[model samples]
Target: MSFQAYLDNIQAKTGKSPSDFKALAEKMGFTLNGKIKPDVKATQITDWLKAEFDLGHGHAMAVYALLKGKKPD
Candidate 1:
């Protein structure tokens, strides 16, 4: 799936947009101002998403990519 597709699937499943996830991540100290914090590991974010949102690894990684300013080709 494309990057946007992953994001869309996540939103469809979780009822949240990327902005919403960003805000929540900030609250969890995984991110700051829409960017990944220096000390935050991708696994930390993915693990939280898995536990809280039931997202699979791929979808969680999509969120990780977004945090790092990456996009699908």
Candidate 2:
């Protein structure tokens, strides 16, 4: 699936947009000022996404990509 498709599916499943995830990530100290913290690991974010949103590994990675400022490609 395309990156946007993964994000769309996540939103459809979790009722959360990327912006919403960013806010929550900030709250979780995974991010600050709209950027991921340097000390944060991908697994930390992915694990949270998986456990909280019931997302699979690929889907959780999509969110991690978003956090890292990746664009759809």
Candidate 3:
């Protein structure tokens, strides 16, 4: 499935929007400092992405895009 598909599936499963996921991530220990900083490792995001959405890398990134507030095409 495509990235957008993964994100859509996440919403369907959790009934939570990307914004909501972001909030939850913060609660769980994700520091969204903006700009994908060097300190911001992909694994940190990927771990939560995997756990929350049961998605692989590609799909996780799609969800990440949405969390970043970028509408995927």
- Pick the lDDT winner: 2
> Cα lDDT of all candidates, in order?
0.89, 0.94, 0.66
- On a 0 to 100 scale, what is the lDDT of residue 9 in model 3? 77
- With candidate 2 superimposed using the best TM-score fit, by how many Å does residue 7's alpha carbon deviate from the native? 0.4
What would the per-residue lDDT of candidate 1 be over residues 1-73, giving only the tens digit for each residue? 7888999999999998988888999899888788888988899999999999999999999988887888645
User: RMSD, each candidate, Å?
Assistant: 1.4, 1.1, 3.0
Model 2: per-residue Cα lDDT over 1-72, one tens digit each? 899999999999999998899899999999999899999999999999999999999999999999999876
Kindly indicate the candidate among 1 and 3 with the higher TM-score.
1
Question: Against the hidden true structure, what lDDT does model 1 obtain?
Answer: 0.89
Estimate the overall C-alpha local distance difference test score of candidate 3.
Answer: 0.66
Every model's TM-score: 0.91, 0.94, 0.61
TM-score of candidate 3 against the unseen true structure: 0.61
